[model samples]
Target: MKYPTFEDVKKARETLKDVSTSHWVQDDLFTWKWWLLLAATFLPWVIWIKYRDKERTLEILCYGLLWAILASATDVIGGESLLWGYPDKLLPMVPPLFPADISVIPVSYMFIYQYTNTLKRYLVFSLLLSGFFSYIVEPIFIKLEMFALHNWAHTYSFIGFFILSLIPYYLIKKLTIKK
Candidate 1:
């Protein structure tokens, strides 16, 4: 078995450094959409901090990370398929996935999971959240030219959002119930 050495990591970093400088087709910064991306990235942390004491912090964070990874997974496919895209990014240095996918969306799911305890409540809130993301949040980005839909529609988004929303909730429920 072979493991990468320290020098290998440094060389990899140097090779990828050009990404921050010019790898992307567009790196719109300080624009309105850029500002919104920044807000989307940090606002969730603020919201989470304000309500920190109400839930199991570790479990909630785990759920949030799960949602982030799920979002990233689907996001990679969507980006590759050209169904949708983010034109304005908060950080071009990172993967093209939105920062808010990791922060805002997942944190929002964590809150929903904490509040809605029953499967019935979970279903209701999940649908509401799915609609909120598909109809409201996605549209805001579409209007701002941050997210563009090519072959995608809000209908497709509702399906994805609804499924993704419930995943963390059920996962956490199963995990904590055993303990």
Candidate 2:
């Protein structure tokens, strides 16, 4: 059997435009959780856009993308490993709530970087803040039935997330410094 090339795949998709308007609407409705998650995830970016200086916005966007990728990777791993699960009501997918884990967490890191230029300081604040949000705030989500933890225990996972946040903080500091 032969695999389709990118162009072939695109052509196939274009030719197979059998999607109905009702199906599109249903898909949109099904993805409402994703939309809400996106809004919540982007709230930090919106705030940053309003309050942040123009010079730093690009830098923050870069860092946000980096952290978002990392967070998404972690979410994929965690979900595949049965570490945690999100409610069907809260998300259309498993583990991550419409990429919120990736996007939101990274933006939060960008906020820390914006305020604190030093790696040590950023790491400290990032760990504390992420820890608080992951441990205290997120457990409430678990309790409220928004999500469920499978194999991953919250105590260690919370600490792990705090440490994980430091990685990007240190990396950003190193990359941003002038030689």
- Give each model's whole-structure lDDT: 0.80, 0.68
Q: RMSD in angstroms, candidate 1? A: 5.7
List all candidate RMSDs to the true structure: 5.7, 6.3
Please, what is the TM-score per model?
Answer: 0.81, 0.72
> Candidate 2 at residue 160, lDDT?
68
Model 1 ranges off by over 4 Å = 1-27
Which candidate should be chosen as best, given lDDT against the real structure? Answer: 1
Clashing pairs in 1: none
Q: What does candidate 2's lDDT look like per residue over 78-155, in tens digits? A: 776888866532333234454466556776777787888666787788778777777886798787655688887777
Cα lDDT for residue 43, model 2? 77
* Residues 16-49, model 1: lDDT tens digits: 6666546344566676667767787888889897
**Candidate 1: lDDT over CA atoms?**
0.80
By summed lDDT, which 10 consecutive residues of candidate 2 come out lowest?
A: 87-96
